[model samples]
Target chain A: MNAPAQPVLEVRNLSKSLGGKLILDDVSLTLNKGELKVLIGPSGGGKSTLLQCVHYLHRPDRGDVFLEGRSAAEMGRRNICAFRQEIGMIFQDFNLFDHLDAENNVAIALRKVKGLAKAAALARARAELDRVGLADKADLFPAQLSGGQKQRVSIARALAMDPKVMLLDEPTSALDPDLIGEVLNVVADLARGGMTMLMATHQIGFARRLTREIIFMENGRIIETGRPDDLLAPASESRAAAFCAKLTELLGH
Target chain B: MFDLAYYQTLWPRLFSGFWLSLSTIIPAALAGLAIGVVVGTVRGAMFPRFLVAPLNAYVSLFRGTALVVQLFVCYYGLPQLAMWLKPFFAARGLPELWRIFYLSPYAASVLIFALCSGAYHSEYIRGAILSIKKGQFAAARALGFTQAQTFWNIIVPQAARRAWPGCGNEIVYLIKYSSLAYIVTFKELTGTAMTLANSSFRYAETFFAAGLYYLFMTTLAAWIMRRLEKAYAVPGFGRG
Candidate 1:
C-alpha cells in the first residue's frame, strides 16, 4: 500500500481571551506534514498566541487542535505530554536551563523524561550538539555562549528530542543584527531538509526566502496566506504585500 | 578578678562539655537538614493544593512552638504511646535497639535537636524551592518530565543550592542551641562549664571560654558556606 498522507497539525475556530480581551478570534490553519509555513505580522498580532495554542501551552477558549488527526483536547495528560514530545518549540528568549551546561541541558529530557540511561543520553546529547556545530562547547553553560551560539544550543536541545514538527516563535528576534544570519541559516537548513516547521517571525525577507507559504496576520486573525513569492510581490493585492511594503520601507530595502 | 588558676581548673570540664555539644550539634543538624530537604521539596512540589497547605501547617505548628516543647513531646509523649501498645512495648521497651545504640544523654539531645530544627529548616527549603523561576518548571514539563522527575532532577538541586546559606545559618544556630542539651543532664560543653562554674564560682571565665568556642566555630562555618556559594554560583547570576 502507498504511504498515507495527512495534515500533521490542524487548528480550527481557535479563540482565546486574556483578561476579557480577545487575543485570538476564531482562527484556523492547517499544516501538512513536512511543509514549512511562515507566519509574519506586526507586533501584538497574536502570532505567538496562536503558536502557544497549537503547542497546547494555552488552551483555546473555543476551538480544536488535531495532531495527526487526534484531538488535542481529548488527549489525557500522559498522551498530551507524549504529543508535546513530537512537537519541538523554540522560544524567542532561547529558554535554556541556566543551571545546566549545554550537554546536560540536552540530556535532561532524554534521561529524566524519556528514561534513557545516563550514558546513552549523554552520547545522544553529544551527537545533537555536534549536529548543531557546538560539540566542543558541551561543557559550557548558557551564559557562556554567545547569542547565536545559545540559540543553536536551544535548537540542539529541541532537536535532541527528535520531534516530528518544530515550532519557532520569532527565534531570531532576540539576537543582534550580526547574530540573526547565523540562526536563520541553521533554520533554513532545517527547512531544506523537509522538517515540518511553523515559524512566526517579523523577518519578512528571511520568511519570503525560506517558507513555501506565508501567512499574514492582523488584529488576531490571519488576513492572507499564499505562496510567499506571489504574496510578497509588489503588485499583489494581498495584505501581505502591503505589510511587506511597510517592512521593506522600514528596512530601507 | 580573672584568675589563671580558675581557667586551668575549668578548662578540662568545659572542653569535655564542648566535645559533647559538637557531637550532638553536628549529627542533629545533618539529620534535620535531610528531613527538611525531603519534606520541603515534597510540600513545594504539591503547592497550591490542599496537601501542601496541611504540610505547611504542620511545619508552622512545629516551628511556632518552642523547641523545648517539641523535645519534651517527642521524648516523653512517644514513650507513653509506646507503652500503650503491648506489641509496640515488646518491640521497643526492653533492650530496644534505639536504647542500646543511643544510651548517652548526648544521643537523646541530638534526636531532640534534629526534630526541633527540621521544622524550621523545612520552611527555608520551601521558600528556596519557590524562588526558582516559573520558566524552569515549564521547561521541565515541556521536556516530558513527570512531576517526581522534575522535582529530583531540577527543582531539588536548584533549591538545595539556593537554600544553602539558610541551612548554613541554621547549622550555626543549631550549635548554639545544643547548649539546651545540657538541661537534659548531657555533660556537653555548656553543661560541663556550668558544673565547673558552680564549684569554682567563675561564671564570667567559663562563659567567656564558651563564647570563644562558638565564635571560632561560626567563623569557620561562614567561611565554608561562602566557598560553597562561590562554587555553586551560576555564572553571570552573581552570588546567591
Candidate 2:
C-alpha cells in the first residue's frame, strides 16, 4: 500500500536551463511536514530557479516535482491555477499587486480563486493581516508600504490561502539592513507555527538561528546538505563548511 | 458684434451643423475604439510571426497614409471599383447593387473615420498594456488567477487608467476633424462657418466664432481628462 502520509514535496532529477546555460542541473530534494529548508548560495547559483520551477513559474526542461505525491507535469494549465493554491510564494522584490490595497491583495485570490464572497474574503484577509501584524495597514496600497511591510503583507497574502508550503526567494535580500529583521521575524514565526517552507536567502545568521536544514548550492548544483551546526562547525573542513564558516563570520552568527 | 439679428440666424445654422457633427462623430469614434481594442489585443498577445507581421502591416498602412487620402479612397475610389463589378452585377440581375457602391458620404465618412482613428487608438492602448510590469503578471499567476481572470481583473483596469490621457486626446481630435464632414458635402461646424462667411462676407466674425466653439469644446474635454487622470492614477506608484 502507498504510505498514507507522503512527503509534502518531492522532486526527482529536476533540471532547467535558461538562455542555453544550465541553471539547475538534475537537482532533487524532498521535504516532510513541518520541515524548514534553507537554500544558501552565491548569486546566479540557481536557488531562485529551483523555487520557481517547483512552483511551475518556470517549467523544468527535465524531471518532475510532486506536491504530496502528485506530479507537476500531470497538471494542465487549468490545473496549475488550482494547484498553486497549496503553495504560497514570496519574492525578493515582494511582488505585491501595485493596483490593490493590502486587504484586497490578500483577499483577491480568496475571492477569485477560492470563490469566497466579498465580505468573507475581506474577513479572511483581515485575519491574515492581523497574523502578520499589519491589521491596521490593510487599506494601504503596495506602493505606499515600506519594504519590510510590503513583504509582511505578501506573507499575509500567501498565508491567507492556508497553503501547505511557502517558497520564499531571497525574502530579505532587497530590504535595507535595518528592515531585514522584521521580515525575517515573520518567517521565524511561520517556522515556529510549523509551516513547511523552502527559503532561498543569504542571511546565514538567520538560518543558523532558525536551525533548519541547510542546502548549499553552487553553479547550479547542490554542493552540500547538512544541519547548520555540522555545516558551520569550527574547522573549515569541506568546501561547503569553509563557505559557511566565512559567511557565518561575516554575518556575525 | 452683439448683433441679435445676426446671432439668431447664425446660431441655428451652427447649432444644426454641430448636431450633424456630433451624430456623425460619436458612432464613428466608437467604431474606431472597438476596432482599436481588437487590434491592440492582437498586438499585445505577441502572436506567431506570420500573424503579427500582417497585423503590423495593417497598422502601418493606416497610420502611414493621411486620413483625408484614406477617406477619399473609401468615398471616391470604391465607385470606380464598382464600375468594374457592374458587369458581374448585370449578369447576376443585380443591376442596382453596383449603384449601392455609389456610397453615401455619411457611410463612407464613418467607415473612414473609424478605420483611420482606430489605428492611432491601438497604438495608445498597446503602449499602455506593454507598460504594465512583468512582476504584475507573475504576481497575478502566483495568486492563482487564471490568465483570463488576471487580464480582465488586474491588467486591463490598470492599463485603461494609464491609457486615459491619450484616449482623451483622441476624442478631442475627433471633434476638430469632424469638420472634414464638409469634404463630402456634409456640413459640420467648419462647413457652417464657411457657408455663412462666404454668403455674409464677414470672414473675421464667422470663422472667429467657429474657432471659439472649437476652443470651448476642447477646453471642456481637457478639463474632464485632467480629472480622470487624477482619479484613476495609481496611488504612490509610477508617477511622483
Candidate 3:
C-alpha cells in the first residue's frame, strides 16, 4: 500500500460556544488527500457547526485550523482570503446569490477573488455547469430553478473554485425524495473522481454505498467511527448502530 | 385677476429663477443620495463600534433639527465662523480659503440642503440595508467575500435598489423645499416670484403660477424615479 499522504486538513481541539452554550466540544478531525468522510448525526449535533468552524465562518473560540500544514490564524487578511479559496462550502439551502443569474452566480467568485477576466470566468462557469448537467439552465434565476437544480448550480459554483477540499452540509436535506438522487449522483461522481470531501448527511444508504469512513455524533460529540458494516450491523451495540437501526425503522428503509 | 399683460416679462424672469433652482436642486439631490449610501452602510453595519454612536448622533441631529434653521445657520452663522478663522487659515499660508466667502449663494445653500437631505436618505437606506436577510451576509462570507468586498460589491447595490421608493419621496420633497434657496437670497423660483409680487402687487397671480410650476416639476421627478426603479429592479427577487 502507498504510504498515507500528509493530512490536508486538521481541526485541532476545536471548541465553540454560541449563546453561552457549548456547541462544539474539543472536536478533532482530519481529512487526508482523496478521502471521503461522512458525518452522520442527529439534528443540532454540531455537524453544521463543525463544518462552519472549519471554514472560519463561526470562528471557534479555541482551536486552530491547519490547512496544508499552515495554521489559518497565522495568516494575514490577504493570505486568509487566499487560503479560503482552497476550501469550498455548499449549504443545504443552496444560498445562490439571488441577484445573479445561474452563470453569474457561479462566475462571481472567479471574477472577484481570483481576478479572472469576465469572459474567462464566465466560460469556466459554463463548463462547471455543464459538468453538473445544468448547461441549459445557466440563465435561470434561483427562484426559477427547482430545489434539485439549485443545489446542482451551487455544486457547480463550488466546483468552479477548484477547491482542494469540499465541505457539504446536508446537501440533500432540502430536496424532494425524487430529486435527491440527481444531486447525490453528482456528488457520488465527484467522490469517484477523487475529490476530498467532508460531508454531514443523514443519507445512510448513500453513506454506506459511497464511503467507508463514517463518523457518528450525538449531543455535539462523536460517539463512534468505523465502516458501515462494523457500525450499522444488526448485532452491534454502539450508539451509531442503534441510531441507524432506529432511522431504518422510522424511515422504513 | 389672471394677468395676461405681465405674462411676457414675468414668465421670462421666473424661467431664469427656475434654472437656478434646477441647477442647485439636481446636484444637491444626487450628492445627498451618494452621501446617504455611504453613511447608511456605515451606520447600519455598526462595524467599528466607536463610530456608531457618533454617526447616530450626527444623523439624529440633522433629522431632528428644522431645515430652515439649519439653512439660517449655514448661511448666516458660517460667515462669522469663517471670519473668526480667517487669521488662523491665513497664518497657515492658505489665503485661498477665503474663497468660501465669495461662493455663490446657491452653492452655499446646496451644501446645507445636501446634508439635510442626506440625513433623511440615510435613514431610508439604513432600513433597506437592514431589511436584507442575514443569510446574504453569511452566504457571501462563506463564498470568501471580505467585509469591504461584500458591502461594496453585493450589499450596496441591493440596498440601493430597495431604497428606490424612499428616494423618490425624498426627491419630491427636494423639489418643493428647493424654494428655500430663495430664503437665503439666492433668487431661485420663489425669490423671483416674491420680486414680481412686490413690484406688481400681484401676489395671487404670481404665487399661484409658482405653485403650478412646483407641481409640474414634482410630477416629472416621480416619473423619472419610476423609470429608475424599473431599470435597477432585480429579476425574480423582490418583484413579488
True contacts kept of each: 0.38, 0.62, 0.45
Tell me the spans in candidate 1 whose CA falls farther than 4 Å from its real position.
A1-6, A248-253, B5-11, B38-46, B52-116, B180-187, B219-234, B237-240
Which scores better on TM-score, 1 or 3? 3
Supply the DockQ value of model 1: 0.39
Count clashing residue pairs per candidate. Answer: 3, 0, 0
List TM-scores for all candidates, in order: 0.83, 0.94, 0.91
Q: DockQ of each model against the real complex?
A: 0.39, 0.66, 0.50
Better of 1 and 3 by DockQ: 3
Clashing pairs in 1: B17-B188, B17-B189, B18-B189
How good is the docking of model 2, by CAPRI class? medium
lDDT of 2 by residue, A1-253 (tens): 7445448999889999999999999999998888899999888999999999999989999999999888989889998987788889999998888888999999999998899999999999999999999999999988889999999999999999988899999999999999999999999999999899999988888898895589989998998888888886766375667776677778775
For this target, which candidate reaches the highest lDDT against the unseen true structure?
3
Clashes in model 3: which pairs? none
For model 3 chain A, where is the 10-residue window of minimal lDDT? A75-84
Per-residue alpha-carbon lDDT of model 3 for B1-240, expressed as tens digits? 677777545666688888888888899999999888778878887668787778788889889998888888878877887788888888999765865764467877798788888988999999989987786777677777788878877787778778889988998998899898888899988998999899989887788778877888999999998888888766765663
**Model 2, B133-152: lDDT tens per residue?**
88788877887889899988
Decreasing lDDT order of the candidates: 3, 2, 1
